[model samples]
Target: MSDAVVGQVAVDQLLEVLDLKELGPFRFRGVSPRVGPQRVFGGQVAGQALVAAGRTVDPARLVHSLHGYFVRPGDPTEPIEYQVESIRDGRSFSVRRSVALQGGRTIFFMSASFHRQEEGLDHHAPVPPGVPAPDDVPTMADRLARYPDRAGIWAAIPRPIDVRYVGEPGWVAPGDRPPDPHQRVWMRIDGQLPDDPLLHACALTYASDLTLLDSVLSVHGEVWGPGGVVGASLDHALWFHRTFRADEWFLYDCWSPSASGARGLATGRMFTEEGRHVATAVQEGLLRRVGE
Candidate 1:
């Protein structure tokens, strides 16, 4: 199959996963991809939980911020049930808490707030200076070609996002990448999406998890898997500052602020290709060497 066709198929699958089955009011069900890791991807749970919360809210209100915790590893073979609590609703703001459960155990939970668009003070930080355009960076396929053995299971997974890295990725062999404080990349959905703003936001939520944690590893040129470090996201938070499309190019500029006690914290800012700062994300994860 052509690469474009494969990409579209992957994106369609992602959309299907995000489209949760509404069991009843404030309750929904989501399933993982048939072919994926043994543990569910954290981004999928966060995005699905957001979808559940969004469905119970007023469409006029756009999600402004979300804070989520990964309480336990999710099983990819089973379905997940999401319950959303309507925390509050006011003239201009609404809050919802979403909990994901499997086997009656809470695996993940998130608190998200939505805001009605209104005229108010507006400003955003400028995009980082002297960064290469998305088109100038090497594609994931291009990079993987140089490290075929390292590709491992990732090569079999469908890529719904077209990512172009500005610096070395976390999957690279140790010593291949020089220590760099900043980890930047340009990315966008691999296929076209409908014009629903909520879907766009959810898609960005999924894409956000892909690389934010890599900033922590890049600081010391550490890679994932054996002979390097293994990690799991403990918590994640995001703030949406402006409207943007998931299908268009955006820069994800990330850096690590600290790493201690076997935990690493990373912060990232998203800017449109046109230089509009649209979103920010922060995450801290448990990072430990193999067999530790």
Candidate 2:
């Protein structure tokens, strides 16, 4: 099959995964795509939990922010049950908390807040300087095709997001110098999505976790691979600042402010190609070098 076809398959499968089965007013069932190694992906859990929260709120409301924790590694072989509880409903604001479970164990938890869209004052930081335009960057697909010998592991795994790095992808080459504290990438869903805003938000939630943690790996000039290093997210938080679409390209600019005591803290901002700051995210993960 063609690259476009290959990309579409992975993302279409994820969209199907997000169409959760409504068990009741406050409960839903979601399944993990049985592909990624070891356990289910963290982004999948966060996106699903946000979808669960959105289901119980009024259609007029939009998610403004969410804070979530990765409680445990999820079982890809089993289904996850999402239990959402209504926290509060105000005139223009609402809150919901959701927990994702697998075989009676809570694997993830999230608290999401929603708002009725209204006109408001707005200001945002411009895209950082010295970053190359997304058009000039080499896409992940291009690099994988360029180096066939080094691309096998990545070729075998087809994820729902298409990512293009502006500079050196930390996972690419282990260099002598510890990288600067930051990294940048362009990203978007691999396939077209419907017009629903909530689905777009949830899709972005999934994409957010794809490479944000790599900011930590960049700090040490380390890569997570066979006998190289190991890490997982401990917590994730996102704030939606303005309207955006997941199917189109967005730039994720990330930096690790600090990393110590086996825990690394990283923050990121998501921007549309037009320079709108759509969302911002922060994550803390356990990072350990276990191999060469």
lDDT of 1: 0.93
lDDT for position 98 in model 1: 99
Provide the overall lDDT of each model, using Cα atoms, as 2-decimal numbers. Answer: 0.93, 0.86
Question: By TM-score, who's the top model here?
Answer: 1
Question: Each model's TM-score?
Answer: 0.97, 0.93
Per-residue lDDT tens digits of candidate 1, residues 120-228? 8988878999999988899888887878777655677778889889999888899797899999999999999989889999999999999999999999999998789
By summed lDDT, the worst window of 10 consecutive residues in model 2 runs over 1-10
Pairs that collide, model 1: none
Off by over 4 Å in 2: 1-5, 146-153, 176-178
lDDT of 2 by residue, 1-292 (tens): 1233346788789888898999988999998875655688899999999999999999799999999999999988899999999999999999999999998989999999999999989899997877777678997778777655445345666667888887666556575326767878999897888899999999999989988988888777777664456789999999999989999999999989998998889999998888899999999998877751
| Top-lDDT structure, candidate number | 1
